[model samples]
Target chain A: MKPAAFKYIAAESLAQALALKAEYGDEAKWLAGGQSLVPAMNLRVAQPAVLIDLNPIEGMAGLTVKEKPTSEPHALVIKAMTRYRTLERSAEIATHCPLLHETMPHVAHPQIRNRGTLGGNLAHADPASELPAVMMVLNAKFKAQSVRGERWIAARDFFYTLFTTALAADELLTEIAIPLQPDTPTARTRTCFMEIARRRGDYAMMGVAASVTLDANGVCTDAQLGYLNAGDTPILATQAAQSLVGQSISAAQIQAAAAIARDEVQPPGNVHATVAFQRHLATVLTKRTLTTILDFRF
Target chain B: MLCKDFSLRFEMTDVTQKRCFVLFVIKMSQTTCPPKLLQIQNLKSKIPMSDLHTITATVNGKSYTRTIESRMLLSDFIRHELGLTGTHVGCEYGVCGACTILYDNHPTRSCLTLAVQANGHRLETVEGLAVSPTQLHPLQQAFHEAHGLQCGYCTPGILMTMKAFLAENPHPSEAEVREALSGNLCRCTGYQHIVDAVLNVKDEG
Candidate 1:
């Protein structure tokens, strides 16, 4: 369980970290929280020759909520190294992005969350992880910086397949920006996060992040169901979501959408769950999540 | 996780076929991996043995500086480097909470953390809990009274984790206490007595 030998450099600034990434390229890895990376290193699954520690970089870890102008949607900026514990207790998140606030506790245990970062979890793009699904449903954007320049990758375009992402070798995920519901009384948005795990802190067998916006007449204007462990990447049930739009969130609509969601996924089976069971979970979670959203009297 | 798709439905009737399957597993773990990985490892990179990093941190309120390999785990630094063996190691991966310690007053898994990452940070291990052998910490005394431990192996970690847990929530309900203990795993005891021990601590102090 010992990690392979490597040169560690605690980058003092963002510029230094980017320069180090450019220098080492594929041979180096930017260490954020080290909750996932170190475990892989200990298993000898990931063996990068150089580890550029980004913790020491100033202004790299924080959370901020920006209330936009009257017509613009509000935004939440979370720096890459901002730990999960911080997000768990953030009042701003609870008020703005309720789905993310609810999903925080399901990421991992308190011990792992104390060291795990939001950016690290998203960039990892694990099929079984919860944050990626949350990010996808919330319409978040990731900022990737390198020696060349910085670029913004949309949440939909960020994750490619499996553990792979659109991130380049020399790029470092700087921060994540999630759009929040507009601060208007008429803008009705409800979100729910739920997962079924054998143990409390174990990796979930199936998880869902569901969000819905209703018009003044209680008709669904938009809907999204982001699922983890359901496909090669974070599966955004587009067809399922489209079925909900323009219809009242009744038992029929919810069941129809859930069925579509169950069929849209290509869930891989494991010892804990079979392909049939995972599909069943997807259907049940989707219906329950949408049912919960319907109960919210907006 | 990368090898989740590797099907084991092949017939293993011969040794040659079994050997080929083992080699394929190794290849999936190391060497050329699937296209899912961001880093394409075609060239085998050398592990730099001589590159040592200096870490200056306060462990259990005592200042210490050590130059060691950057890949050295924080749990090993506490046990081997600082000679604080009270911190136990179960699963080196972050799943088991046996290597839990307080990093900057937050209960953190030292196994998943690198020693070099602890530079200029504050770490509290299990050895720092008691003042002496005769006078155990109040929580430890409560455990001794309530029979919280059986094998006594996962005690240090559970105590360290609860030390921070109780600090955050001084008066927690039984369900809340169980939720806080979700990270720490105990094999021998069914956690009924361990939960009793933690609840007993709140009554005394």
Candidate 2:
């Protein structure tokens, strides 16, 4: 199928891209990897009068790791246009955010990853997408820029609804900043990402991401559990995460937390899975992820 | 299909213009006409042109420049315009990887990529995989010996995808080959032969 006719503009710089976006307003759509946008356009689900291609904008595709002092937290900064393939293969990402590294292969097929951008995936904000849950678990910050100015939105606040975001029409998602887990020899941090899809590369029926910091005594000091396809947006299981903190990871505690997560999530039924089945999957995935991260079998 | 529809619409517009011209001539000879008639003529003349983009890319080691509609897919450009039909398009959507090609050495789905977006880039289609019209690449030879294809429709894309995958992983295991080929679907053969073919090549080395 052919896409509807639209004016195409290749932006040479970020300033020019922003200016073009401001000029075209809502009628213009930004083209990152075009993995999702082009398909939607072809299906006539999305029709923009103009397309602002961001591939030509220099210095917009890369990953940078910032190691701060012991008092300050380290961060992994990724440009908006950095492709998923880069993140999957980057040793820097593996060292800084191993959870993301482990989760990269589950995003889609390698062909899609070759062209799919990190910002595009986040901006698309599909409820079933893996990156959103990973970002939520990692406490990533998104930087949105407009001709007016720039502002930072937490990953939790950035995703508003299915295929919708807190991003303004003219604002471009410029960068993603993920705070790296604290490196402490005495206290170890472990993260795990897991999902179940009908097919290997298909969208997840339900996904879970968990990050836990355990002290020398094996007591949990910090925990974050995020679920994809749990609701309209990536959901943070706050009650479950809180239950894990101040306690050593145990099979009973994991089961209790997972039960709470299952009760807390309100997911809708789809052709792939029923609402009850999704809730059950959420509990199972939560238990599996927590146990996997703790390196314990239950 | 959209191209056919566009041409049909253009022919219908031509017929309508001819009929309008005849009516306008008749009215001019009979009496003064309303301003609406002249406005219609002006509007007909002002029919906007379709949005077009000029792209320059190196396809199969040769540089070419072409002006195409902004929405023209790279698969169509390679198959219809460039006359390189080796890259088969199974599903126009990204789901089917039959249109896989090497975009700047990375396996990409040509159907999902716009020709305009490929401007100033390098592309290697299925046509470029062989050394010549007669000689086959090592992967193709392996496929031939292993009978990796049945209908042969999905072979081009599979070869392209595997070529890139094998370049990254010279000696991939059976499970790795299956994982690498997860994107491309083949209906004719259950894919055991294809996996065997890739493994055969690895074994040959």
Task: Residues B1-205, candidate 1: write the lDDT tens digits.
Answer: 2223321121112232110111212213343445323342443356555678788999989999999888789999999999999899987877768999999999999999998888999999888999897899999998999999999888888999999999989888999889888888888899989999999998876
lDDT of 1 by residue, A140-249 (tens): 99999999999999999988765667888889899899998853555588999999987786777789999999887888889999998887688999999999998887
Q: Each candidate's chain B TM-score?
A: 0.80, 0.76
Superposed model 2: Cα runs more than 4 Å off? A296-298, B1-49
* lDDT (Cα, 0-100) at B122 in candidate 1: 96
lDDT agreement with native, every candidate? 0.83, 0.83
DockQ metric for all predictions? 0.36, 0.19
